[model samples]
Target: METQMGTVEDNEGNTYQTVTIGAQTWLAENLRATKFQDGSAVNTGFIPKDDDANLLTFGRLYDWHDVIDERNICPKGWRVATDNDWKLLERAIGISELEVNKEGWRGKNDIAITLKAAQPDTIFKKFNQADVNKFHFFATPAGVKLGNWYITQDMYTEFWTGSSATEKDAYARTLAYSWWNSHKGQIRRAKLQKSNMFSVRCVKI
Candidate 1:
């Protein structure tokens, strides 16, 4: 397989490495920009960098509102991955396009094992297992934040899709270390409340 790597700069001046998978260019890291495209502060659901190590690894957690802001959360030339964008990624990895766009928890449970990043031995040393990472997407287990509490720090990983399912809920994708294979256990397409926070990954426009 052939791969090309590059870099993109955010409005905040943070540079992220970009990897081309199939025809799509994806950020090799989670978005850590603290401002929108216009340079306005992103105040809500932005986790402060109390721990530089975690911030560097996971990037920032953002709510759906922050993601869809007209000012734009991603860096210039890139935008948050929409449902279709994610479907394209899945298809690139050999998942049927038929299973790609399905709304709720679709696709075989093994897709997560394919796209999920290999957990660092420095962080998850006990779990010696590594992900297949067929496309070099480098999706880490950044976990999610709920209100004042941070839960599932190292166990579960989720990313927000630009598509909103309803006024109250938005679409997202997830991978979990637990139950690596059960009928709908590992990878799931979830419709979560807009306020629920998850990590963001951007796709080139």
Candidate 2:
């Protein structure tokens, strides 16, 4: 697992640090661009109140439509990570190939904690388990945007995969603490509604 670090600027002129884990290179930060590469507005989804600071920390949330649009939400030479891309990342971090493809909470050996940013008030902190951020992925608890409200800002986070699971839903990965009993600090593969909004992380093509 050779690792490399670098920087890239998106079409919005916002620059993000990038990291290479295993064979894939990824944006170390969540994407905050509000427009597509073609200069079209990405649906704002739902911006929470006092989000001026949150925008910098957590990045903007986008529905699946914005993710799959041909105009491109990620920077040049990069794309939203596909489901398989995520599996590669999981394997790089020590999850077995068998567990990476599972549909629910997966991974052993505190693998989910390895992806979360080390914040003082995060769920990992509550359990006295430090979020190592071993791969420098910097996943924040940006939460999710539902129909007219935002929920769980600092307790959980999810990312949309470019792959679709059904006409109405798409594949996603989730990180949470005690979301369901006994499922603390693990990653989940989910089929989520396309209309709901989640954080985005780009991978180099």
lDDT of 2 by residue, 88-108 (tens): 999888989888889999988
Q: After TM-score superposition, what is the CA distance of residue 124 in candidate 1 from its true location, in Å?
A: 17
Candidate 2 structure lDDT: 0.83
Cα-lDDT of candidate 1: 0.75
- The superposed Cα distance between candidate 2 and the true structure at residue 65, in angstroms, equals 0.4
Q: Worst ten-residue run, lDDT, model 2?
A: 119-128
Mind giving the per-residue lDDT tens digits that candidate 1 earns over 103-183? 555555355555656633333223324445655666776778778767776677789988999999898988765433242
Q: Go through the candidates in order and give the C-alpha RMSD of each one to the true structure.
A: 3.8, 2.6
Off by over 4 Å in 1: 48-50, 119-131, 179-186
TM-score of 1: 0.85
